[model samples]
Target: MKTRLSLFALLAAATLAGMTSPSALAWNTLNGQKPIVIAHRGASGYLPEHTLAAYTLAIQQGANFIEPDLVLTKDGQFIARHEPMLGGTTDVASRPEFAGYKTTKVVDGVATTDWFASDFTLAEIKQLRAIQPRANRDQSHNGLYEIPTLDEVITLAKTHGVGIYPETKHPTFHQGLGLAMEDALVARLHAAYGNDRDAPVFIQSFESANLRYLNTITNLKLVQLIDADDVNPDGSMSLVDPYRQPYDFIVAGDPRTFADLLTADGLAFIAGYADGVGPWKPYLVKTVADGVDRTGDGHLTINDRRVDGSTGVIEAAHAAGLEIHTWTFRNDASGYGFADPQAEMEYYFNLGVDGVFTDFPDTGVAALAAVPEPGTYALMLAGLGLVGAMARRRKA
Candidate 1:
């Protein structure tokens, strides 16, 4: 349980302290200030997801953390992408040669037919171009980017003075091929950032097996994604027939079960390995009536704090000694269920979730500044000089 981070990275991270996050300087400190500034898919609002250009721009935008959702290549190398398929987010289907790589599989209990990375090797994957997933977003930079490797991401972030928060996507599905994504990822992270679980970098996953395996591998701080399956008064990990087993067994005999994790005891067990929990948005504050979104708020909500304070999921997470963070925040019209970006974030802020994931950092940063203690902003500015000095010194 010993984690060690390089002093150089500490100085580099110092420049990112005092982010505009709601918690700001109240969160953990590394040598000084700096709230974790995670770039949602490499400043994705500005560029395509998982592209090196996107990651580079994020570092330039003063993001302390650059997120690269990890997927494995056919050769077992890890690359950044929101999912295994490249069709939706990248230009894959259009490619003539990769026609064979197109297929379908049930992912997270949902059927998806697209280009899967597991179907292609590293060489073939690099040949494809990444496109902006949202047409209404930005697309001017499309077709000019190449897929990047994990090492490439690390090296890029190192030069810009930042760390990556890599989430292991679909752990069990990938594990079926004897491909241990978490183990490989943690090993690489430790090799790159050293064996510091407390390092500025974070490794998170929706799968508890992924997180637990990471805990046993490296001291890197881990995070568990709490979704509908992770919660239930019955304390069942998952109602999905395959994921609800209670023994040291597998899903349809694959050697892992959703039931293996997600307990009051399971959450506690995870706390031993991770420092935070990224729960479903509804878990913290949602507006639901007969499973319908009533009133002005949307249906896919996470917490009910507008009135019932004790029933809020954020409070529950805090009671469990875990800071609450919710995922997939974006100001783009597609994600705003309440029909207003400002109002949406205001709802989350009122609920007291520790942090949020947003495609638009500027929007989130602005929202964070409006909160009570934006002490991290001061740290970020103070640290700015260091980052500039480093960037300049390197340039010189």
Candidate 2:
């Protein structure tokens, strides 16, 4: 069985040999550049996330960037974990000795009862190990990797010559805990990569104020992440409670929802403080529940939703001079009318997303490779002719 990747490589190689113009295969991205593949939580689909091993694997997998969601520790140090909560992504729950650290605190308005990273010192944190939070993912590597600090993740990114897309997870919550990460994160990033706007670093945040604050302190690229709770059956986004608005918005009594950020006015507002916008994939494309099994997999699922095409967010962002990077493309779990994860990514890439945050970097890479660059239709037609000729020869 010839893999799709192998097939794409053959066609692409054949197409490239006769190409005269370098711009023949220009991408549809904001700057006509190839879309970047950011390894979300460091190739998270294949490994326990946020460990040095995971980060290293992501770099090895040809990711343009490795993402590390940053949270602070008790001693004012930045570490890579999905959130401050250690119960889900680490072995802290099983370690009886450090059991006293378990407690309840409201994180981004939800009362979360778990072992938080902020309660543990950097030295204490080292004793704990990483685990696969998702029950559906591989679990054999659960106790094998240690939780890595932000410095370690940065070092790995620099060594591999890849970019770092670090999200400041729950900035408002971290600030209230007296473990504010923005200042320390900026200072450390500036020290390592400098304050250059073109540095191989993009600091992302769900909170607007923190990114606005970051803009004044550093010139490194900042992305305002737009998030939503869920997608309604009618293809509308569910803007419920905490996930409805940036947590900081709730704190400041702002009434705008995450969906509002995609408006021309909202994008123009974002362009003031950030270089890019990272909306959840659903925000960029429209999908509708039309009662048809698009994938024909028995029952209708989110994957069976009818894809209606771009919702104009990408074009709007580009119009505002903001790059669009969407999130959480997983092979095991694809959403919104996409059964094939690679094909799903290709669709987004075709729609001109500047980057994609995927757990499987290799799939993302392969998908990007499969996209027909601008002016490549002639080459594809030729490749198809070549395939037909080969088939006829084999038949003879």
Candidate 3:
């Protein structure tokens, strides 16, 4: 079976072939003139996520930055994992030696019984091989790669001249385990790259307080990640749910939802402490339908969901002088109510998103290349006319 090129892929090829104006380059960001393509969990779609191999693959795919979601180990070492849970993304369950560590623990308020990363020392973690987190993805690479430490990920990025975008996954939860990710992250960054604002790094988190704390400690850029659960079904923001509010907000008894953080006042508050915001893609372009259970059975059914572009969140962020980088762009048609990854990316790009976190970096790169500048369509039309004339002459 032949593969069909995505719309963005065709656009990229045309742009490269001089069919579009030269100004139709990649999208611009606060980091640089070109839109940044962040490899979500390090080319996670190809290899085992958070592995050095995956990071290397993302770099090869032309990702401007590679993301590694950070979690703490038992011995207080910083390691890369989507979450502290080891069973889902590693072969820990198959090992008999670490079977004793299997127990239930509340992770970020949810009760998960697995071989938690916090329960294993850094040495113990090295013994286990990283596996594909999703069952649908290729499992051949599983057991072939090992979980990488933050230092290893940084070293890989440095060696390849790619930027590192590391997120402090479950910062409050890690702090409860006596392993404050902020301190470790700051110390590691300081030792390696110093307190340079322009350094090729961006530390991100879903929670707000830790980012505010890091603002006092380092000059490195910080991004605030927003989750889907932060928004209520009625289009209002919810603060009562733990997932909807920052853990610190809940701890301090503050009644504010993630939606509050996106307002002009809220963005001003974030601007006081952080460089940018990383919202879920839906926050920018939500699928709207009347009387339809978009969340039926707790999963978004693709039937009636239509991409009603721009929720004004991007404009609000840009107005606050804060860059916006949205998350988790995949080539598959599973969750994002759209068939074309290019269209989804282009929608965000047109909305002036500074960057995007995609599991497939190549797709993001292509989509960014497809975004045209002013007068690109005019040039495309002229090119098409010229091509038609040349074809007619050849036929005659």
In candidate 3, position 369 carries an lDDT of 79
How many clashing residue pairs appear in each of the predictions shown? 20, 0, 1
Write model 1 residue lDDT over 1-396, tens digit each, in one string. Answer: 011223334543653542244345453322223234467888788889888998887777666678888889889999898988789887887888988877888775668898888888999988988999897888888898998888899999888877788888888778766677866787788788889855767787766656766777787777776554443422222345333432113333544333333345655665777777776554444433234443345643422213232234555556567765676676764222345554565567655666667676666666655655545455555565456656656766
Model 2: residues >4 Å from true position, as ranges? 1-25, 295-298, 375-396
Instruction: Assess each prediction's global lDDT (C-alpha) against the native.
Output: 0.66, 0.89, 0.81
Model 3 segments beyond 4 Å from truth? Answer: 1-32, 230-240, 286-303, 334-337, 373-396
lDDT of 3 by residue, 308-341 (tens): 7778888788788788999878886433446678
Q: Which pairs clash in the backbone of model 2? A: none
Ranking of models by lDDT:
2, 3, 1
Specify the poorest-scoring 10-residue window by lDDT in model 2.
Answer: 1-10
Q: Report the CA-based lDDT of candidate 2 relative to the real structure.
A: 0.89
lDDT of 1 at 217: 76
Give me candidate 2's TM-score against the actual structure.
0.89
By TM-score, the best candidate is 2
